[model samples]
Target: MPSITLIVNGASKSLEAWDPDMPLLYALRNDLGLHAAKFGCGLAQCGACTVLLDDMPVRSCSIRIADAAGRRVVTAEGLGSPEKPHAVQAAFIAEQAAQCGYCTNGMVMTAVALLRAVPRPSRDEAKQALAGNLCRCGSHERVLRAVQRAADSERA
Candidate 1:
């Protein structure tokens, strides 16, 4: 157990000596009380625990907390506030993209990261970027639409 400092959601914070092998997902949820990032598969096969590390989506459940030290981590909570929503979050709501809502955060974060990389991703690019994220409720169509909607809204 070694103490490590990490930048999460634009804040510099420190974690006490915890198990180095523990995944970042647990640390964020249990220790940090930031439960927006879900834990779908601890093995990293599922993208349920996606978060942005330097604006790139990464599966939190796969990476150890120690490995995240000194990096900027942005969770869904970091994306937007309740009063002012991020374009992606606003678009998701506008498109009614969520069904059960379990995968929405990760999916939204993935889409946000994708749009950051390519403002106007082609349909295929959108699909490929979101491939790792799974929505068991079959919201892919709406999700894609939401991304496109966000892209449009961002341009406005």
Candidate 2:
């Protein structure tokens, strides 16, 4: 097994290599003990395993650890802290966007990237941006509001 170095949450993490094809989610969860990204569909269809790879949201469950090697990875935990949450995290909390919370991590991660790209995105834009993220709990409305709130909060 070889060691793969990854910049996770702005920190360099060395992963004890298992398989080159293994999903990045496994290493992040099992090795780093970061469980924010869930394995909802093994496939990349569900946004549950979404994480920021170099400032863009990618499906962790589908992305191989090798592909993520030497890349900048940011998980939900890396987004912010309890005392000073990221604008998106704070907005999600304020808007009560999470239902079961299973999809919250992905939602937050996606919104974080979106807000960075389009700080003042319209409601429809927000909806389209998060179209890939599936929140079976039917929290779409709140999620959109949260995105808007995050944009507002960030600009404040």
Candidate 3:
């Protein structure tokens, strides 16, 4: 087993890797108990396993545990705390953006990354950033509104 150190949600954690080929999604959920990032398509076709790698959103399912070493990994769990939630998370809650609840984590993480780059992303830009993420419950409209709300809240 290869030991790897990962900075997840601004916290450093060390885990023994059972397989070098283990996907980050498994490592995150099985090892570290960070299940906020879901498992949809193990092939990366779906955005259910999306997480932030050094502030950029990446699909954890496609990335190996070895590849995640020495990088900042942030899942939806890292977005905010119960006492202090990230603007995106807060916005999503206020706007009721989640329908099935499976895709909300990925959506929130994507929105967080997008806002970090563009505080006031246009509707198209918001949609574009979230293009990889899919909501089977069909909450695209609410997701867009949540992004907008997050942007507005950030400016406040």
lDDT of each: 0.91, 0.93, 0.90
lDDT of 2 by residue, 47-153 (tens): 99999999999999999999999999999999889998998999999999999999999999999999889989999889998999898899999999999999988
Worst 10 residues of 3 by lDDT: 75-84
lDDT of 1: 0.91
Please write out the lDDT profile of model 3 over residues 44-133, one tens digit for every residue.
Answer: 877889999989999999999889899999988887887888899988989999988998888998899999999999999999999989
Off by over 4 Å in 1: none
TM-score of each: 0.97, 0.98, 0.97
CA RMSD for every model? 0.9, 0.7, 0.9
**Cα lDDT tens digits for candidate 1, 1-156:** 578888999998898845877888888898899988998978777788999988889999998988899999999999898899999999999999999999998899999999999999999999999998988899999999999999998888
Question: Which is the better candidate, 1 or 2, if ranked by TM-score?
Answer: 2
Query: Which segments of model 3 are wrong by more than 4 Å?
Result: none
How does residue 38 of candidate 3 score in lDDT?
91
